[model samples]
Target chain A: MSVLAFPPPVESEAAETLRAEVRAFLADANAARTPLERAESWNGFDREFSRALGRRGWLGMTWPKEYGGHERSAFERYVVVEETLAAGAPVAAHWIADRQSGPTLLRHGTEAQKRAILPRIAAGECVFCIGMSEPDAGSDLAATRARAERQGDGSWKVNGTKLWTTYGHEADYMILFCRTSGTPADRHEGTSQLLVDMRMTSGVTVRPIHDLMGQHHFNEVHFEDAVLPPDALLGTEGQGWAQVMGELAHERSGPERFLSSIQLLIELIGALRGSESLAAQAAVGRLFAHLVTLRRMSRGVAALLEAGDDPTTHAAIVKDLGATFEQELPDIARSLVDEEPDLRSTSDFAAVLAYTMMAAPAFSLRGGTREILRGIIARQLGLR
Target chain B: MDDVSSIIFESAQRLLSDLSERVSAGRPMADCERADGWRQIEEMGLPFALMSEAQGGLGLSDAEAFELVRICGRNVVPWPLVDTMLANRFATQGGAAPAEGPIDTLGELTAEQKERAALARAMQMAGALDVILVMTISHVQERSQFGRPLAKFQAVQHSLAVLAGEVAAGQAAAEHAVARLARGGAAATLAIGIARARIGEACSKAAAIAHQLHGAIGYAREHRLHLYTTSLWRWRDEYGTQTWWTRQVGREVLAAGPDAFWPAVTGA
Candidate 1:
């Protein structure tokens, strides 16, 4: 389907009011942080900041109030997310739980699991990590080699490894995607999701994987014959493939996909505050054009998510388009301003540029690679 | 987007489908004045659709009123509907009576006229790009190469995906500006500038990929492809050359400065 087939987004007045509230909160919260620190973007972890957001009822903004949520519209939650991302607030501590895990539990989790985990997530006291990507199964997720089998007594034994599990060591639980009944070649037939409680489960090991920027944003978790109770199964047997898709639809659609580099754009504008160069103005204006359009598309997908429709196809398009915008940002900055990129540079422009230049490559590589995303879009277009 | 827009959209589609059949039977819309189509259109009062209700027109928002213009673009209708709608609305604003018939595509425009015309051109180009994508997707799916449909190849699939992105983004930029056009402020000015600039870029890139994929048939005058590509080429240059608007947007945005920039985008 054409992307124009998406419904036009209309934000309520209450959502805008919530936006102003978020902007005010961020101005105070982010005041003391350095530009270089702000350049850390979404991965800046501050547990206190996460808890503060919970106090403001920004966490779990769309879930049931009975689950410690405020039950606001998704647009309001969207407003809060865009503002925090624009401000470069340290939001990683509660990002995963707030964005996907709580919603996943509310969808496919056992009633007991939702009761046990949902409130703590809403309170920002719990952090969640995804356990989908294994070393052998990055893009070909169905090739997942991780296994969890039933014991005769109704317990479970988990084995194999999960790669690139972001913040796994720090997370309270992992919604693991693994094989239960079939061999590795059985792409979709035998997979199931199990909620691995890092504290409660035995034989779980998280080995850090430092990226090229020397950041510890990802890890590999190994389950060496890990033991779990009967209640660990997340959804139903043989439904992990479908359940993981639901999680990914949530994973991909959000203001974070596009607003991750607002700080870079801000600093670029600040540095060239009064320049009359045609190149600078046209370049910045072009960036704004892309931003405005991307925001509209992303908001449309948010509306789809809010209305309880599966937004996988539209979300992939947004994520791909947003990644292109983000990946191209540092080059635009370098062209407009004459600053050399340096992480320790005294100039905020230089430092932020340096940070973005290093981090920009991951924009297209993470979540899902660009090639993979385009294939999804192609299939949606009926090319497959 | 809204009910009125969809209503006009469906009406336009039906009207154009009937007229296109007549053209296919050799009464090409370009050859004759096609006064019958014009009369039907005038009955719908599309010429003054942008004017407020007091001005003897449907009081539609700029984006809503432009649905007729977009449909005209999609069908490559041989009329100056875009220019007429824009001129009529502008005439009412200037204390002149709304124009009775089609307006000139060539004439020096006032400052405000130029901005509105640029937005109108972008809207038309957006629609043309959409239809071109539909045509190209069908061609790639049906045409064979090396014993397989072209779309079955990974290379063609990736290229078409890129084309779809451009089409989607171009339409979005135009829709955003059209929604802001009726407001008519500094924000509107910036929005129009963005649409004109970005859609021009999308047009260039999208046309290239689409034409390449269609190969020889797309380049021939006999094919329906020229009907849209020619319009895309002409519209991007008519109101303001893409180069001129790109620079204007650049200078104006810098003049607005960074602090005012993001707020302008979000309209907060």
Candidate 2:
């Protein structure tokens, strides 16, 4: 069998209608936002905008209705997401919460925990951050040292730090993956995921870590003696590794993975519209070609995920392939267009180019690095 | 329906697994040899894959027909299944005679015929790449260096992973093109262009890596690698090179302008 066989994307009138609905919303919602701001898209934080989508029933779409979700198909949710990202709507405020937190809670959260958090998440009134990467552990995620020791009263105290926590400062909650019972030498053992409410926790401090682009979204979230109730644990204790792995399929394959650099492609088309260069035309055309294939693969993953199949391998391929296309785009755009990367330029193309060029590195680096992803694929191929 | 598809795929696979050896030695099948392979398939009713029931054909879906073409490509069938399928499909559709014998070279083709042929080539290349990936994996797994198999090495594993990814991408591209082109709408033309262009790129990247991983042995013309690699090198440039399809679709997208670009892409 081929190592990658993504089922063809499923399209329905319902999904297409949702797509149109999302586009109509974006046209009005993104009217005042600058192109540069829209370019940020999923990373462009706007609580009000996230709630607007929530009220429209665009958030927590695939979850069960009892949890305040719309109980829609994954394909329908996928259409809404791709439209949002393709139009570059500001989705950062509720991205993590809607994408992973709610689903993780559905799968692993206790009844009370699900009742308390899922409704708020579905309403887009709550925000969540991932507490995975730490000071000494980025790619070696199992090397996590952040320990959440059990207390005598059956409570838990979390003491460690999580680095590169996106939107940590603004988050109302954080899914804290930490060592629950064992040492760092235990590798993936003795680890558990905790639901840490940022407001409810007293010892948590979120410090801004300016990115290379002088952005302040990523933060260092410190848990100094942060205590949690016994119910804070997500899923079975000591099963953090498996749960996190499941969450990754959600994170790695999505519209945003491929659509992150879409603004540049839009700008490239605008710049190259009337050009007589076949080289430019073909290069630009090939990008769209790659986009469609990646989109199919991603949608296939979504379908598999909805059907309760493990799409981890397929998801990895989408992320890897999508990131490659996204990162290569800026250079291809630069070659086709004469404009330099200028963030402050009056030209929209140049401004989009400037941000995308700088942001390109993170395309492969974030979520999972190039090497790690390839390794996962290799393992799937039975090389390991 | 799926069972019928699989039956077609399996029979093709069983026949091609043996027939591929004729070309694996880096030589075209002689007329007699080609005839034998063609006769075997003719008996099995594969050439009728794309025709409708009224045409006395198997009435397979376009996706299924293209998949048969893909199987032909996988075995490096040294004859003309693609040309025959297209010729017969278009001929019977237009109420003409299907080609009588095993086709080696194509006759005059229309621009639309050419595009369909390109889609066929795209799937063929995808199939050939899939074979190359399997061959490369086998090579790395069984062949050893520095007291361990190449598959045991991280560098080799990573390279093979990239090759596998390319192979998958090419397959997905061809399949995506088939899905859209079968539907036959405004997006069909652009879909083929995109798929063909992307598949050509995949053929290049994957063939090169498959060769690199095989080292000096893969360079041998007698090596079975040549069958798949050479086909990719030739097929990618058949109806159109990567850039040809790219420019064709790109110009259309450009003329559509930035505002209409995304809508055209999604076909919404």
Candidate 3:
């Protein structure tokens, strides 16, 4: 079907009002922190800042009001997310929790779990980390060796190591994905997710792993027989693979996936205003075209999501193309600019360029690698 | 826009589906005699929709026309809906009686009148045309660059794409203007300009791709694709070049400010 056939975004008076309010807040925040000081992924984890957003009912904007959400439309939440990403706000504190965990809990958590956690999560008093990737099992999540054995006392004992856990060290809890039944060869079957309290866990350790940019944004989390109540199991047992995959749709297809390098591009264009070189012009033109196409594709996916469609294949397409553009931005910037990009430079342009250069590699690797994404696309096309 | 559009779309879609069936049943569009093509369009009453009820038309808005163009583009109909609409609108605005039959517009000109006349005759051969529109450019018959035809240059190809885009945009705009004029609104000059710009770009791009793929064979008569692609090149440059419409719309938009540009171009 033609992309244009998709319903145009419905104009909302409430959304427009909220957008204006968000613009005002961003204008103030931009003046204060100048987000360029933060990491490329909007990495300042300010609990207080998150709480402020929560107070305004912006964090879990689309969740049910009974679960401490505003019950706003997904498109409204999309506007907020897009504007936030574009402004480069310090949203990392509530980003994962609000984006995926909140939605997942709403979909599958018990009444008790919802009453206890949803309000706290919406209020930004608690934060969560996804514990799916392991040292041996990265993109191949079905290969997870983490074990959660049922205890006689009606609790579960979890023993596992999850690698590349973003914000794991500071998280209040880890949504642990482990094999609860059957053998390793079972792969996708016999697995379940147990929400383990990071504070109460007896043998839980989080060790920071510095990245190539020397930022301790991710960690290696080890759990040794950490006990959790029976109620800690999210949704049904042995459905962890399905739940995680659903949660990934939220994680993978978002404005954050593509807009990370946009600020740098904007800054680069501002700097290139006077240059008349053919290469520079063509570079800008090519980047603009790619960006437009990406927006069209991404918007199509967003429209589908709003209409309550799965759009998994379309999301995969967006991620694949978005990754390509993200990787190309730095290369284009490097050739366009005459000066060397320095992270410590006082110049905003230099700092943005430096951040994008360091951050571009993770664009495809994080969430899912480019090769893995293409393999998924190939499968969707029935090539495998 | 909502209620009227839904009805128009529903009805037009049914008609287009019926047209598709007819085209698929061993009857190519070119096989239809010129008079037959004219009769078919006249029965559709699409051309008469350009003038007001006072001047004989069912008044429709520019937005409606845009929707119709999108529908037509999606189906790839070979009718001269765009060219006829432009001719009718220009005639009505110029206080000339709207042309009775299919009035086609030409975009390119060959050196000799005979060649031009032959091209016109071919268009007539395919279907009846009341009028033909044409544009002229300097000939590059024997020029070579880097031991090849100058037309084979990458830069030349890019320029052609831009030209095609301009033509497509104009054709779309002119159709839109006709619809708006039928509704007795002030002429949608700006919308027409925007469409012209976009059409020019699309046409040029299509032409360049065709030429690049065809190489020397593109200019040869035996290659049927040239009939469409070359016409696109000629027609794209005829109504208004990309630069011309771009400057016209750009100046209007600048005068109106950034906020008003969209509304002006969209006729919202």
Report the alpha-carbon TM-score of model 1 versus the true structure. Answer: 0.94
Ten consecutive residues with minimal summed lDDT in candidate 3 chain B?
B128-137
Best by DockQ: 2
- The better candidate by lDDT, 1 or 2, is 2
Candidate 3 per-residue C-alpha lDDT over A285-378 given as tens digits, one digit per residue, 9 for 90 to 100: 4454344334444655677887888866566656766776787887788887877888888887888888888888888898888666656554
Best by lDDT: 2
B141-246 per-residue lDDT for model 2 (tens digits): 9999999999999999899888888888888888888888856755677788888878888899999999999999999887989878988999998887777888
Please list the C-alpha lDDT of all candidates, in the order they appear: 0.83, 0.86, 0.63
Off by over 4 Å in 3: A1-5, A274-303, A371-384, B1-35, B47-64, B77-80, B86-97, B100-268
In candidate 2, how many Å is residue A256 off? 0.9
- Top candidate (TM-score): 2
lDDT of 2 by residue, A191-297 (tens): 99999989988999999999989999999998899899988999999999999998887888787888998888888888888778888787878887888778777
iRMS value of model 2? 1.5
Query: On a 0 to 100 scale, what is the lDDT of residue A66 in model 3?
Result: 88
Error of 1 at A342 (Å): 1.5
Chain B TM-score, all predictions listed: 0.87, 0.92, 0.46
TM-score each candidate: 0.94, 0.97, 0.72
